[model samples]
Target chain A: MIQFDQVTKRYSGGVEALKNLSFSIDSGEMVFLAGHSGAGKSTLLKLISGLERATSGSVMVSGHNLSKLRGSQLPFVRQHIGVVFQDHKILFDRNVFDNVMLPLDIIGFDRREAARRVRAALDKVGLLGKEKVMPIRLSGGEQQRLCIARAVVHRPAILIADEPSANLDRAYALDIMELFKSFHQVGVTVLISAHDETLMEDYGRRILRLKEGQFTA
Target chain B: MKHYLFLHWQSARTALAKILRQPVGSLLSLAMLSIAMALPLSLYLTVMSIQDWVGKLTQTPQITLFMEQSAETADIAAVSSALKTHPRVKGYTFISKKQALTDLEKRNGLNGLTEGLDGNPLPDAFVVTPASLEPKQLELLQKELSGLPMVEEAQFDASWAKRLYGMVDLGKHLTVFLALALSVALVLITHNTIRMQILARRDEIEVSKLIGATDSFIRRPFLYHALWQGLLAGLVAWGLTAWLIAVANPAIAEFAQLYNERVELRGLSPLELALVLGCAVLLATLGARLAADHHLRRVSAN
Candidate 1:
């Protein structure tokens, strides 16, 4: 569960990224965050993941208040939330298996069991045979899928992706959406931020629209 | 618990891999650190060896009180009584001129040479043993005895001993200062090395942090890498020091032959070697820990 009660986040130098925004999402719900380039979607998601704190109002994830959470407690808050960035933050130095196994490794899964889960996550993303392959060798869509596999590898309760399908073609974008749908169908709460309304409309989920740091709907 | 162990083991394994991945860089770092370590260590070895050599020689400092050749038996008695009551003199043995002449005749071939002499040229003397072996203390005792009436001269053959003691003192101070400076330099070297590794892996570390990795988890591999580097450097320094001692041993033995003294060039003891290696590892670990904590906090702030 996520809640933002009239939260306002202002950057240094008088830049208000999000102003007095209030929203809440229940458990087991898939919500689409529809917004333009500077609509504060990424900022909202960051606040929910405890990466950034609210300036004035309270932001709560589960029962813990994000504003009151100290730096030491952030990791525990983050372990249960999976986040995919727009830039596809994949490690090119290591092979695909190690990349996907990162979250499980963070959570300290056994080596054999972590390898098993990594394979399953990779298989789900349709990159099963490319386990030993380096991330640099993967195509754009494969790399984004690799990011997705990493996010969901630990079975986080809430999955948040920030424009995950940003540079993909229509087909790959649809496949990425379908992957989110599959995870949601398994009762995992999912929130995705995207500019493409049509693609999100195809999934027929609840859409939360934002325009210029304020919720439009 | 099992998972925790596995994570540590995995970090250690990755640390080895990272070091092996860049063999030239790792080897160069090891060489620099070993030389840094060996400079101070070699100095320490030299000081200890000198100490060992000096320790083998007779160091009981004695002061000789020579009586005036014109003095009679009363003068000898005066000087002898003064030496007996002196607090600094632990004991004194008097050698009369007749006894000195007799001892001279007992030498290798000086029997007839001393017999033909008109009178005994040797003065009556007292070989006075001081209570302390310290050069300054013995000098004070000699000075005190030299001012005695009817005393021709008060002598202590400790000039070479004084010089040796001074050199040993200087060596000790130099060794400590050099060790401290090199230890600090080694810490900085390790810190910079780990800082560069962190910079190179900035993306990797950022991603790891985003994926819920704790700071300790992220720092584990870098710490292990520093540890391995320090351990390798220690080993190299030990080997180099041993080789140096080996090369100098024969020369030292030959030099000692001139003095009819057998000197052995021994390297560091087991305890000292352990101390050197332990210091290396501890310094490296401290540097890596500091660097990792600093850089990771900056990365996570974003």
Candidate 2:
């Protein structure tokens, strides 16, 4: 579950990204945050991820007030959540399997168990046989899928993806949306931020649209 | 607990793999650290060897008491007996003024310089060997002997020992200064290397942070990389010092032979070698930690 009670995030030099915005999402609820380029979608996700604190009010994730969370507590808070960035931050220095193994490795899952889970996660994202292949050799959609595999490898309770299909084609974008839906079907609470309004029409899930840092509907 | 051990083992294995992947870069970093460590270690060992050789002289220090020229024969005999009865005196050989002149005349070119003098210019003296070879105790003996009646001056004539002491003191101070400077150099070198590594892997680190990686988890591989670099560099420095001593030993032995002095060339002792290796690892670890902290914080802040 995530809650933002009158949250305000203002960067330095008086740039207020989010101003007194309030929202809440219950457990097992898959919702999409829709906003334009300069909207506060990424800022909202960062606040929930403990990467950035709300400038004024509280942002709570899984019953913990993130503003009050100390630096030492951030890692523990983050362990229950998985985040996917827009840039598809897959490490090319190693193979695809190692990239997907990052989350499980961070959480100290047993090797055999981690390998099994990694393969399972990869299989879910349709990258099962590309384990040993370098990430740079993967196509754009495959790379995005690899990021999804890495995010879900540890089976986090809450998954937040920022622009997961930002630069991909319509088919690739739909594929990524379908991957999020699959995780959502398994009772994983998902929050995906995207600017495209038409993509969410067929999902039939709740959409929280923000226009200039305030919910439009 | 088993999972924890497995995680550490995996991190260590990954660290080694990362190092092996960049063979040239890793080797270059190790060589730089090794040369930095070896230069100071070589100087320190050289100074220690010099101190060791000086320590082996084994001759007890001597004090010479020169009697006043106008002193009477009875006063001279009294001083001689006093020197003989002193507890610290191992032996005393009296040198009369005539014997002193005779010995001076036996030099390379001044055979008859004192032949036509009206009287013997040299005073009666006694070369008294102290039972203690310690410079402090010998100095104390010289002070006590100078207080005796009819003794003009009592002094130590071990000028070579004094010169050696001065040089050794200077060498010791220089070694300390050099050690401090080079240790800082080593830390900075390691810091720069780790900084570069962090910068190169900035994206990976950010992704790891996003995926719930703790700071320690993110830092493990870099720390191990630093540790490996330190260990390899320590070994290289050890080898370099040994090689330097080996290359210089024959010449040193030949020089010592000309002086009819027994000298043995020695490298670092076991304890000292351990110290060098341990300090190398420690400095490098500290450097790596500092760099990692700075860069990781920067990445997380972004």
Candidate 3:
């Protein structure tokens, strides 16, 4: 579950990225954050993931207050939330399997368990045979799928994708959305930030729109 | 703890693999670090060997006893017999006034003139050599020898030996100071290298952090990179020092022989080698930690 109450993010340069944004997503719910380039969509995901602090509001993700969390406790909170970026953030030097295993390794999973989970996650993303292939060798669609596989390999309670379909073609973007929908069907809370109106229109899930720095439901 | 260690090892392995991808760069960095570490260490080994040589040379026991000119033959005999009977005294020679005059004349080219003298002008003396001449024991022996009833004065002529010892002491202190300064420089060098690496890989770190990787998890690989760099550097330094010593040993031996002194150049002792390695590892780890913490904090803030 993720909740934000009047969240505002103001940079020291007098720029406000998000202003008075209030939203909540219940457990296992699939939601889309739609906005323009600077409409606070990425900032909202960052706040939920505890990657950025809110300037003047409360942010609660899985019962932990984002603003008050100590440095040492940040990792524990992070372990419960999975994040995927639009850039297909896969380590190109490593094979697809190892790249997917990154999240499990970060969470300190046992070796045998990590192997099992990596295989299962890769399988779910339809990348089973490509485990040993380097990420650079994969197509753009597959690379995005690998990033998705990596984010969910640890079975985190919540999954946040920041512009997950921004760089992909329509076909690949639709495939990724379906993948997110499947993850949500399995009772994993999913939040996606995107400017693709057509993609959001097809899904017909709860949509929160943003303009400038304000959020409107 | 076991889990943490396992994760750390995995991260380290990944880092090693990544470095292996750029073998030339890794090797060059290692070579640079090794050369930096070995310079002062070789100097320290040479100084230690010199100290050991001086120590061995100063082990011989020798003392001088001076007596008054008014002392009689019986007093001289009593002093000689007492010295001969002393447990620490290995040998004693009575230098009578005539023998002393003869020795002085031979040295100063006054032999013929001294032989024409009417009477002996030199006083009675004794040359006593002890079985052991450790510094503290030699001082004690000097005190006891001066306490003899017939002995008017006892001198140990330890000035030359003391000066040698002082030089060795000063050398050790200087080595420590120099080693510390160089170690600090080594830390700076490592820090700069890692900082460059962090700058190059900024995007990777940001993505990792954004995806729920903890600071320590992200830092582990860099830490391992630093550790391996340090270890390889230490080995390199050791090899360089050995090579330099080998090249210089023959010339050093020849020079010592010219001065009528047989000195052996010593290699690093086990403790010294261990210390060098430990210091190298410490500096590298410290540098990596500093760079990672600084860059990671900034990136997280951004």
- Point out where model 3 deviates above 4 Å: A132-137, A167-169, A215-217, B15-23, B65-91, B95-125, B130-157, B242-262
DockQ of each: 0.62, 0.54, 0.43
The positional error of residue B61 in candidate 3, measured at the CA in angstroms, is 3.7
Report the CAPRI category for model 2: medium
- What lDDT does the true structure give each of the candidates? 0.89, 0.88, 0.84
What DockQ does candidate 2 score?
0.54
lDDT at A188, model 1: 91
Q: What order do candidates take by lDDT, descending?
A: 1, 2, 3
Per-prediction TM-score to the true structure, in the order listed: 0.87, 0.85, 0.82
TM-score of chain B of each: 0.77, 0.79, 0.77
Per-residue alpha-carbon lDDT of model 2 for B1-302, expressed as tens digits?
A: 78678877888788888888999999899899999998889888888888887766536567889999998899988998888889988999999998988888875357777767887889999999898877788888989999999899997877577789789889999999999999999899999999999999998898888777889999988888888788789989999999999998899899898887766668988998899989998999899999999988998735
Worst 10 residues of 3 chain B by lDDT: B107-116
lDDT of 3 by residue, A35-117 (tens): 89988887788788777789999999998888999866777787788888766667876799988887777788888988999
Q: Looking at candidate 2, what is the lDDT of residue B291?
A: 98
Off by over 4 Å in 2: A167-169, B1-9, B63-83, B92-127, B132-157
Cα error, candidate 3, residue B266 (Å): 3.0
Ranking by DockQ: 1, 2, 3
Number of backbone collisions per candidate:
0, 0, 0
**lDDT tens digits, residue span B8-49, model 1:** 898888898888999999998999999999998988898888
